[model samples]
Target: NPRDYKSYKLLFGNEKFYDRSSNITLNYEYFYSCIDNMNISIDQLMSSIQKLQFMVVNLNSPDDDPQLIFESLNSTGVALTDADKIRNFLLMNENLPEQNKYFQNYWQPLEENTHFEVSKFFRYFLTIKNAQFPKISNVYDEFKTTYNNLDFDKQNLFEDINDFSNTYKMILECNTGTKKIDVILNRFLELNVTVIRPFIMAIINDFVSNKIVEEEAIKIVELVEKYIARRIITKTPSNALNKVIATLYRDFRQFQDKHNNQYKDSEVIIFLLLKKQGSGRVPTDEELIRNFKHNDWYNINSSYRSYIFERLENHNHIESLSIYEGLKNKDYSIEHIMPQKLSSDWKNELGNNYQRIHENYVNSLGNLTITGYNSKYSNRSFQDKQNMEKGFKESHFVNLNKLPARSDKWGEAEIIERTNQLITSALEIWDFPESTIHEMIEEKEMYIYDGNETFSNYKIHGFTFINDEYIPVKTWKGLFVELFKLLAKIDLNPLIECTKIDTKIGFESAIFSEKTDDTE
Candidate 1:
């Protein structure tokens, strides 16, 4: 028996002599045996038999093209799926792990270099898709580092990645046979810590993909609103959460405005929450109103807060009225007469250092007071507003400054003079109580410096040969006369007003005129 086994093995050792004809014969015999002995139907037997034959053929024919093998297998009436074929082919290779690594490394660069085109690498990855898993820990580490390093302006990067992760998680939930709602909710809670509204929207969008029908999306949004409300009630309130909600409400409102649509259900809930709480709900609104009503006028009915919200809403600067109630107190309601949002011309005149002044002085209620005509005074300069108010005979009740205007164009000397006037007026308003107004005035005076001679070059230079008794040199009269000559050269009228000159230089000053030649 041992001799017979050795003789049989030696006879079959000539693998080069084995051909496709012999392989097919072997496969046919195996299929017949499966059909007869396994009690399976001929189709089932044939289906089960082909995959084994494919593996054998692939193994024996070392130089056989993979594409040809795939095509042949596909053409055959076989039950083995594409995934199964790939798995089997990978299992047959001794260096499968090394080959996979080589393919992944090679393909990554090619795909990235080609701008992520659907190339051979992409196809290969798809073929061996199950073998690849994301390095979530590494990804999260990088995300945390990047998030921590981001400046305020660059915060959107973390937001985008968070959104993508949320989307991926939603997909995983659908396919994975597990209920990990807690994990997902925790992730959402962490995301809420970051004020990134767009990322939240992206997550919502992804979650509501093809799985959610149109009507169901509406239901889902309602559920999300409820969830947000519940979380606000249970969780510790965060400013970041409030900002995210505010931003989302704003974006939704913009969408509604542009499309001429009504506010969505979720947006309405968010708006309600914003109005009720500065950021998120703490105690219920009823409890808050009841507790604060007796003493807190600001908390009870925030008139000033409502006014700001109304103004912002009217201007379309903010889409929704979320902070309407939060800003409602006497202390908070003062509107800045010199609004922080300055015009381009004003900003240019005020050096970049003006930001500090704006934050400290302009944004404060002391510098802000309710105006009867907020829209009309919106972008008007302080001087312009003063003129308008005076002409209208309106009481400038909230006096942030007594000066006629705040001007960036003014030099340090001019600023000091204005500051002195403002302080005097402020003292008068405060009933001239023993105040530090004088000290503040003195401090502003310290900023003043003597004018440099460099400014002299900017002045017009002129000389006038008048009657020999009076030789004028660069005086106002001589300058005007020279200016008239320049205008005359340009064919412009050289009309001079004796009254204007008298008003400017005094009536006692000599008045001179050159008679015009009508023909010339």
Candidate 2:
């Protein structure tokens, strides 16, 4: 039980009570039993056991790579693991005094904080900073090499590692102050994604450095939660998520042109996310609504679907249900409105379209909800469930679910309508705020045309800005046509399409590069 005094329990059988008296009593009984069974003297048995000596192998080589030597020695037979190797490698190069200092300061604190999960934490840290997952055994080698390439010297390196470990622990524990972010992180944790950690770590740095306000930080983290959740719901290629989030710090840097820093981090993150058009696209409300209608609620990971249920059930309700609370207590379970095992009454309620309704709506969002009576009322007809103990009407989700708003019969039409309603609510819950839209500037397409001027005195005059810089069109008509042909592909947007301007020829440096060709 998580709420137990230990938050965990260890049971003892009293058989291994290792007191001196018990030890002697057990040994004497063993010796007496041996003597009775085999006619062996107690003294001889004791002497034989005492004569056995244990051999210890200590491997040391200043010339060899300690890691290689460790791997060579530690096989299936030994207790040495990747974590042990990492600890040894990190400490091996330090002087005696330095080694003890580092161990007492950086290493011990992390070990205590992570509950001796130091190796796993180190791998997570490496993955976050490097954007690539490391093999467990190679983590120390990767860390050693990668740390050398970084800007920090040895002293700063340890300090940076310690600082990052603290952030990792905060995120891993979901101890981030705000309730909303903490809840969202709990959902993320349940989704079994540690890939988002690198991105979160970067954001936490931004928070610590005052690059973004706390509210904006929350918005960014929440958007990522929705981004991953929607991808899971739509069954998109999740391998793309790691790549997207891994390079998030790089993605954030792309916005560092002059006015970029003036924008709120929420705006920057949301715009960058919206601009992702391929597999990385944060799905639009239309896409979400469409997918939610058809998504198989049962086939989805229970944790993910449970998160969706919690969001649905808690919307507009003051007393929120914690997913953690549910885990620690018998609180809620996902209940299918249209039972998985259909009764005669359910078939009749769905009418002659029973198979169609069953196939489409059985595991769908419209027909599923959070319920306290899942085990008790499961598989009953909707009407029977409505009448059962702690039934649908009493469920906390009833207000949000609005079950009876449609039809008492709960058929295909009602299911479709409810699917639409729930999806709209989902959009409201997970949607990125619309106020951030103004932060993005859409690149408008531009077109260039030869101005109507006499054959001799012709000039490129599309706007006053361009016409104003009247470099007379003469032999350069060939130049402009060549330039226009080089630049134009039907319509060209200066921001989006101008690949490069050949600046060696002075005409290529013409003001037209910055000007919009306003004329048709």
Candidate 3:
């Protein structure tokens, strides 16, 4: 029996019996014979013994032996096929009555302790192993339960599980034959379902970062859809998930540079719409359809269009204006002031490149405004539209001009100038004083001197100045107070120089008492 043990140990490269092998030929023959006689396959037996040895080493002294075992297993050039069999065998053995007490005394406490870095992975592996191979449904249930029990505000429950699951999947796929069992187990313990979105994001980010699977971005979109659906139904939607999806879609569109493509534009538009709307409720199908039709959102990707409308509806941003009397009424549309097919005369006057300029500026609602009389001036030019409504009676629902006209031919420079003008107009409309307005065209020159002698002179161009000054005077405190009150209205500082002056007055008085005494 000892000789048989020696032969077996030699074949398996058992460290304890290294000296037992003197002849390579004899060792090899003995190893093959043992494999044939035991009616066990060489691969199977080696795997079994390896796993047993690994478990024994770690169980004997986990603090030290686990690391050593990991190194040995990793260095042995063991086949993943064999490693997997050994792992399965050990996992099965964990449930044995004899091993239960050992696990409770050693592994259980380690798994439960949060301070240990490996505890999470260790516990997860044990749980999964004990449960056997779980179906997706079972996994989902486990995730839901785990999520329900967590305190989200205190712990970032989503990020942790997402990382673990991704790592776990990678390990399962790679099968590198390294027995980092403790690491694997720790990951399993830390995992929960809340991490699904983050895991998807990580995968998408990795793909994008590596540029390995550019086409796989579609898969990310599908995953996002699933995540959104699940969260909406479960009422546990993550704001982080929403923001990530929005940002990812935006980046993807930018990478594609599909500016003219309706699909790309729709995706960006939808993302913006959803972001504008706050979270919680999901939009109804009818509401989505209505908004899309009313806004002329056709020729765009249907799914993306619906998503934006839905998000807006969810936040109550798309509700009827009549519902809230006090709130200002707002309606959304895509207004084209210069109709797409312009007349030859207008185009010639505007410039031969008018189509491009018009598309750049006149197509969007930002360049348009809400007016009650949509039918009367749907596609009129600025001048014509103004003339048509000049004598129109004022009513509560009267059509007001939406956007100021482009004074010159529509071009890049003209568009930029008009945009700036509109912004300034908006500021003024909001009660900004003319003096306080920042003038981009003007330059201010300042002269500074030391002891009234000029020392430095410079001009600060394209910057606005704010004047803050007070008067200093003696015996004119009342005047200073009045000056300040007046200065508040005028935004310029008052320049004052102090000077002293004296005045004399002549008067006559009678003094006869002293003179009369001298005479007496």
Candidate 4:
């Protein structure tokens, strides 16, 4: 009893009082005081703990069903986890010897290797088979229904689960024992893109089963990365991605079957993703490029911003630095070249329309760069930032800092130039997948944008925004109205702000107003 007290004291020591990860605090002093009164206090505590009553049900008859009883009894309590029910149902009917064999061969290894994430494993595994994610609360019932529907023995089901669990483990660990695959896996993990895992696991399963080579599998993962990265940049809603990624592999397989498996897996994936329409369509190169300049990327997910900068700096380089490590170590940060808070010097350098310039490009990619001198560079003028030690001129990120270091002025024109440069590099990093199969898609009559084109010379059929579905335009006024409607749907605050600024819309009267008579 004294030895047990000492062991537990070591576990709940003063140094172990608080856990940051779980946000739990232990009252180690009280615990130690109770244990210090060992003989009297612990004896009373142990007696009370031992005397606590628990109802035990005994199933003595041949017709007794332990699984049903277990489910019924646990219906109102702390609630058994899906994993608990699944594990019990798996071994509940077997004799002790058979249970031990199955536990040792399949279930135990799966539990341990997945780091006890069997519930999540079951959900992803079921998603692969069903092409839809099971509700978190319904995982047990969903898996039970799946088990009953299929003609499967315990060994066959166990084998399938055990095999898939190994792949799932690699994904969770982000270490697939192959450096190339692991790198992409790390990106997916960093972005917290959990919805893509079922499809990723399916591809990895193919690679393991010898259905596809390692190279092709790597290509497919990279393709998926491009898909995800583009969608994020184009500001696509994440809720739509789950359905797209869940059904992608099934659709690919069906497409392959139809073509008699003539196409490579990567080619099939490209065609399948390209064929997607509406909210599910893959963002094209043009859309990605446009978003790079237009979107306030600095305010998006920090992990996504890190991924973009890292790829831009390191892609095709002879030497690479880990931007993630630099950022985490506090030795680097995102620097706004055009400082967020402008001083008189910055205002003068930016010219008379400084407020407009700052509002437009302050958080855009061109005005941002990673720097080790974040504190020193704070609110400094552009020339000072360039000339300061360990500033843009001295930064090791040659791809990012080089062009800006050479620039003499920082203003709207400079931001636009730098943005165009960054956009070019971004295109190279997250380039669209190309295939002759793309030519197979029927083209809509999209008129090219030329400054000299007149509405009177040609009939405008429709227009599209960011590669979305075409919206028909019957008149120039109709086109103007529809464009504003789409923009208002996205965000009306910018439109409302436009009415307050005289220079914004170049109109004699307010274009948007609360009163209908306020505008001509």
Instruction: Tell me the whole-model lDDT of each prediction, alpha carbons only.
Output: 0.38, 0.67, 0.36, 0.80
* Model 1 deviation from the true structure expressed as Cα RMSD, one decimal place: 31.1
Q: Which regions of candidate 1 fall more than 4 Å away from where they truly are?
A: 1-203, 206-208, 211-311, 314-335, 338-383, 386-520
Clashing pairs in 4: none
User: Per-residue lDDT tens digits of candidate 4, residues 124-231?
Assistant: 998999887888888999999999988878789999998898898889887767777898898788788888999999999888888888888988999999999888
The regions of model 3 sitting more than 4 angstroms off are 1-144, 147-332, 359-369, 375-377, 390-414, 421-520
Worst 10 residues of 4 by lDDT: 511-520
Q: Mind giving the per-residue lDDT tens digits that candidate 1 earns over 1-520?
A: 2223444454455744434334344564576575678766868866866767434443467686664575466666855433334333332342667555533443233323333322222222221211121132232223334435656532243233333334434432332122333333333333332232233334344344543234434433433433343343233344334333433434444544654654443444344333333334323433322322222212212332343223322222224322333233322233445455877655665568666655545532234334444454556665565557431125333232333244333223343454344334322321211111111112111011123222332333333222112233344445455646555576654344434443534322422533321221
lDDT of 3 by residue, 281-326 (tens): 2333333333322333323433333332232222222332221121
Task: Give the Å error, residue 304, model 3.
Answer: 9.9
- For candidate 3, list the clashing residue pairs, or say none: 120-186, 121-185, 121-186, 121-187, 122-185, 122-186, 124-188, 124-189, 369-402
lDDT of 2: 0.67
Work out the TM-score per prediction: 0.20, 0.70, 0.22, 0.77
Candidate 1 overall Cα lDDT vs. reference? Answer: 0.38
Alpha carbon deviation, residue 366, candidate 4 (Å): 0.7
Ranking by lDDT: 4, 2, 1, 3
User: Model 2: residues >4 Å from true position, as ranges?
Assistant: 1-71, 75-80, 135-137, 257-260, 327-330, 405-407, 433-520
Model 1: residue 156 alpha-carbon error in angstroms: 28
- Error in Å for residue 404 of model 1: 17
The list of candidate 4 runs beyond 4 A from truth reads 1-43, 438-520
